[model samples]
Target: MANIKLKGSGYGQFGGFTPYGNVTVLAFALATTALGAAAESNSTAAVKNGDVIELGILPTGMRLEDAQVIITTAMTAATTGKLGFVYEDGVDDAAVPQDAAYFINGGSLATAARLRASGTKLVVLPKPAKLVLTVGGADNAKASDIKVLVYGELTGPK
Candidate 1:
């Protein structure tokens, strides 16, 4: 049998390394939980501190489609940072942004745009703030609402 050293300078012995029936259970630990799905009040999920969180529909029902989308929230506007994505003809082909898209990506608070084609994937990576899937798309020629699934560990104070 083996033994372990205890703290408090008091020598306490624990069961040595073993197989079944050798080391018995002494104690257990608790677990932690996470937040629920919901947009925060007073703009909990809104853009804060000059953050550029990718826009996604809240409440999980919006469908992806081709149209003019106005991000009324003050966080989406930017004269220049990144267009991130572009789509047309049911595809995000190789071409420059045109009339309906080029301007939507650059603006101010409550003014941002996005585009999507049927059966294509859209991805957005933000510099600040967190993203989640708010809505999803249905059939063709419809608007889709999706949550922004953030990738990687964000290190900072909340």
Candidate 2:
């Protein structure tokens, strides 16, 4: 398994559109080659089961409304993933620990379809945090391309 960190705008904030007053959406996309790379270093390796892909970040005072995974290209059979967040270092709040599968848990990546959160789970970040995707199942290293869309709102006072 590897920890892949997508580089060069492979993932980042989705600009120009706010669903509502303070709501924003973020999008992360990766191809098989990108997913196979090592953390912070894009090497053409192979992703394995249990590989964790560090997607991007969510700012402080942001309420995570929902997350969706879109499989633009189908992955290997049985490949699955879980989307969640982990607070960055120095966060004062401890109420919210890292939830590896807060959004989609063991969701299938074997087919090209849109997968969303299992339930209405809302998380307000006490500080800046890293959004992540943990890949699972056999032959995940063979996955093609996929995208993750995150929706959130700035809860701080304007």
Best by lDDT: 2
Can you write out model 2's per-residue Cα lDDT over 29-71, one digit (the tens) per residue? 8678535443333556676788877788878877788988988
Candidate 1 lDDT score relative to the true structure: 0.24
Candidate 1 wrong stretches, greater than 4 Å: 1-46, 56-65, 71-83, 86-103, 110-158
What TM-score quantifies how close candidate 2 is to the native fold?
0.76
| lDDT at position 46, candidate 1 | 24
Deviation of model 2 at 22, angstroms: 0.7
TM-score for each of the candidates = 0.20, 0.76
